[model samples]
Target: MAIPRVKHFEITLTDEGVAIIAFNRPAHRNALNGEVYKEWDRSLMWAAQSPEVKVTILTGKGKLYMGGHQLASTADIDESKSRKAVKESIVCVQSLLNTLINFPKLLIAAVNGPAIGIGMTTLALCDVVYAVPDAIFLTPFMQFGFCAEGCSSYTFPSRIIPPDNFISDVVAIATKTTNFPPIAIFQTKNLVRARERETLMAVNRNECEVLLER
Candidate 1:
């Protein structure tokens, strides 16, 4: 299956059935913006429906994995349009979180470098995470006076593997996973995630509501 074309993400499906979604905004440190969010939603949904793709791996294009939300986008909002801009931003974020919470495929994250803010919090949504030795994971919500988003409040305790082979190691694991029966893999993931889906959705709603209030 052909991967969908996206401006902010580079999507590729390997022969081994691993779909790699790279955050391609290197100049912006791979920050998430409205366009990126939309692309991600489309890409993941496409991958979930692609029989050729049995696993999905998310990583960054450059040194930094992801810098989180594009604060500059918010900074650029005109004072006169502040309310509308904030509300749109809240909707965009909540929509992305909803997609992640309901994603049915095996999702993996390869932290190439620093993962800040939403980048750090979203790792909880991945089934597996691999990071380089110097990769920094930080959620500075308190500094920004914002509560946790991305269901991190309920799923914060994540396991991380240090760089032995980085992307290659992650790909190896994904390839192995793909070798299993696809239905079994999908069902197992759904069973494991079923218990927390509701909680994650609730957290996402509450977080977005608070952000909107602020």
Candidate 2:
């Protein structure tokens, strides 16, 4: 069946134990806005309480995973609106990440394409991550005059990447550089697998099989 827009989430069963939560927004590259956040929060809560869902695979509909908060949503915000939007945004992201972090079930991120800003940090909380080799990443908050949120401060450094991957340099840049890509700044074995974008569905299916086997 075709999935609808309106910030709705698509949950499909891949196996007995694996569920996929696809962020079904293509027009804006699945960017998270307030409405999307509300829907995502509701969807995650629903999944968390469902007995049939043993794992959740986070992904996007179109080529891009997510480009972070919708730039359009940021438009016309007064100081109060900005604060409220930012605060609510943080809460929405934190709520989803916390659910994944503490959920007994596994959380896997299928990075079909670029995942910018909170999109990148959210993956850090997942149990496993799979990325397309060509995926671009960005954390543009500092460059946009904001501080880090979504618990990335603790999660980022705690994970380790390959020595040859320049983990230290990446971390240093994220810490010092304005609006840097955290994915490039650190490496991690947490990424259990990686693949080309063309094979994303196959890789997702394979990951689901692995999760079911566990």
- Every candidate's lDDT: 0.84, 0.58
Report the number of the highest-lDDT candidate.
1
* Residues 1-214 of candidate 2: C-alpha lDDT, one tens digit per residue: 2222334567665334455678878877788877787777666666566755555567776678788877643457687666666556555655555554544445566777788977887777665666666677788877875555444554442233333433223323223322333243222312432332224333333433332332
Candidate 1 on 99-205: residue-level lDDT in tens?
88888888999998999998989888888788887899899888877777877777762346666667887888889998788889779989998998888899999
Q: Per model, how many backbone clashes are there? A: 0, 2
Compute each candidate's TM-score over C-alphas: 0.92, 0.64
lDDT score at residue 121, model 2, on the 0-100 scale = 76
Whole-model alpha-carbon lDDT for candidate 1: 0.84
Residue 98 of model 1 has an lDDT of 87
TM-score of 2: 0.64
Specify the poorest-scoring 10-residue window by lDDT in model 1.
156-165
Give the residue spans of candidate 1 off by over 4 A: 73-77, 157-165
TM-score of 1: 0.92
